[model samples]
Target: MLNIYKMYSEFLSSNIPYGGQYASVVKLLRSAKREILKLIKTFLEKDEKKPHIGKHFVPPLMDAVLADYARNFPDARESEVLSLFAAIINQYKVAMKDEVPRIFESVFLCTLEMITKNFEDYPEHRLKFFSLLRAIATYCFPALLQLTSEQLKLVMDSVIWAVRHTERNIAGTGIKLLLVFLNNFKKSDFCNQFHQTYFMQIEQEIIAVLTDTFHKPEFEWHVMVLQRLFSLVESGSLTEPLWDASTVPHQYPNNADYVCECTIKLLSSAFPNIMENKDLYGEEAAAKLLRERQRMLLVLGLIAPKMTDS
Candidate 1:
């Protein structure tokens, strides 16, 4: 296994250009790298019983991944390097706590730099990037807390960007990643502070995408995230000055009222279009419109009502 990984790492170090005529070779190497990663993951998962695996193998494997990522290949297959880091973090968990910052810069920050400017580029990096975050947030959350304020903010911002992406897979993964982070730390002061700072912004983003006709496929995910957000506010888990902290008087009574008003406005804007165009158009089209309307009502009738009860 070590010999196989050494060969892979040496290839990454060599001046073999990625893509172009070398695309087939790169693809083949990527498959081999993935198999190596799976073996590494399996070994680490059993490392507790076999301490030699942890002591002898995992460190070198992590070094190889960081080195591969540092090569900064323009191709999407660079994402495989991230997958390797994710496997390590998933297996080692808090044992990788001190190494998290290094891993974050190598995988998260580097990948973010590549993909954030244009979601269309490096599509594979986008998926694997968030997947790496999921591994960190789920298995080694304490490591996330170890990051500096600016770094953590970037992490949050990237996830929000992911949620807003037009690509379904990236958006879906983004919402799931957000939910995982929220759920893991919901009981902590960190979660409360996070909501206090970004709750409204996050809520507004989710609402925008939720109402978007193009994002209908992600409706459930949007609702789930919103439900979690509202729960934090309602349960007093996420506290106030939520409206206007700088002024003498608050703008809204609570988070729910603000959300409800937004819902009303959205429904109002969309309602007239449907009413004016009473034509069925077609069975599929009409049903889709009806489903869209039903979704809006679900937000208004079900979710918003519960939110107001808060």
Candidate 2:
């Protein structure tokens, strides 16, 4: 097993065409999956007895695999490489079982770090990275549950970054992942450590993104962010107090005034696009525009009462 890992590591570092070399390596790994799984199972047993896997092998192995993935398949279209890595990680999850917490922590943190470092270099892979994050949130949530407050804050920052991403699809996925994180954890999980101030910052960031005007055709994508914010508001997980008034850059005496001002601004920004070419566009386009306009209104309506009471 060590020999195989060594060979694979060397191959990844060698001067070879990544596409061809990666395909051959994947085939070899697939063919040896059973044997590798057995070996990992044994290593996991040894980890229980000696703590070596957690302390030594798992972190480096995860690092190596992720580096290879990032170096070779830094494009969204490289689905094969993405699938191969996902499969490899899933198999590790299966074999590690009880030992997955440590392994997952290493892998998860590494993945976040990789994304942070390489985000600009591989803009096309943003959605793919987000997809991996969603999988982590879905399948390895227990590991996520074990994150320290600082680590959780890092994750939140990443989610906010994703939500603010320029690409509509990537931002939409970020909203979905944010919802998943919120659903799985109690409000206290985030608020307890960071306090309402941090959440207020998040809300401010989200609202800033939401206020941007997109074309009529891109309205649904904009609505997704608003919907997620609405969900947070409705659930009482994100409260009116957490809405930062300063995000609007207007001098208001109180939160209510600030919110109302922002609400009017949002309405003004959206209304023109919604009303523009209402009769000129096709039925489907008009309907979508109207729906988006309604969604924006709905979000403002939901928050208006709270803002008023504030």
Candidate 3:
């Protein structure tokens, strides 16, 4: 195993003279990385007595990728290497508590700077970057607890940027990443702080997208995100207890009620005749109108309770 790892490190650092040869070598490295990850997973699964996987295997692999390959040839290998890191994060997240901050700096931030100059550039990196973010947010959430305020904001900003992008896959990944965060990190102080900072922004974004015809396919996910957000607000789970030093934002004394009112008013304005006779339309049109009204009512149902509670 150590010999294989040594070979992997050497391959990462090696400068192949031929471009074609380098591409082939990278393909080979990708395959090897996956197999090695599977082996590590199996070792841990089988309860091997001394799986030196985390210490000996992962650290060296990270160093080779970060120091040797990435520094030497910046954007050349990020998409490939980040894919590997994503898998490693899923596999070894528990052991990665202390390492997440460093990994986020080296891999996540570097990739962000590389690809986020414009929406069109580094398209592959854009997709892989969100995938990597999802991996971190999904498996290594506790690791996120270690991040300071600024770092966490950058992470959330990245997700927001992704969800707003024109590309469907990237946007879907971002939406799902938000779902993962909402579902997983329910009551942490950091989670509440994040909600305080960006909940309205995120809520508005999701609402806008949900209403946009372009995002029709993401409708279910949009509904899910709202459901979770509404549930959190309705339950007051996001509120910092009064005993804590932190105070609620004065701009919105009750977030759910504010959102509920805004949403109802928006729906009423957009569909002024929705409350009128659907029977005026033909059968097909009336059925479609009914479906639209039902969907809107479904969303309103989720919000109305919070308004009443507030």
lDDT of 2 by residue, 1-310 (tens): 6457545545544523455647776556544543554456455544543444445765565564444544542221233333333433443443334443543453445446555674465554466667666666755666665667677777788887787766677777887787666556544455433434454465556566766753233355546645654555445554335444566454545444444555566655756766565566698897997787667666756546655443
Q: Which digits, one per residue and each the tens of the lDDT, describe model 1 over residues 195-245? A: 666777787788888988777888999999889877766666555545555
In terms of lDDT, the poorest run of 10 residues in model 2 is 73-82
Give lDDT per model, in order. Answer: 0.74, 0.55, 0.71
Q: Write the per-residue lDDT of candidate 3 for residues 208-269, one digit (tens) a residue.
A: 88888777777899999989878887877766522222443435556566557656866677
Model 2: how far is 174 from its true place, Å?
Answer: 1.8
- Ranked by TM-score from best down, the candidates are 1, 3, 2
What C-alpha lDDT does candidate 1 achieve relative to the native structure? Answer: 0.74
TM-score of each: 0.72, 0.48, 0.67
Query: Which model is ahead, 1 or 2, in terms of lDDT?
Result: 1
Model 1 clash count equals 0
Off by over 4 Å in 1: 1-14, 17-35, 42-52, 247-310
TM-score of 2: 0.48
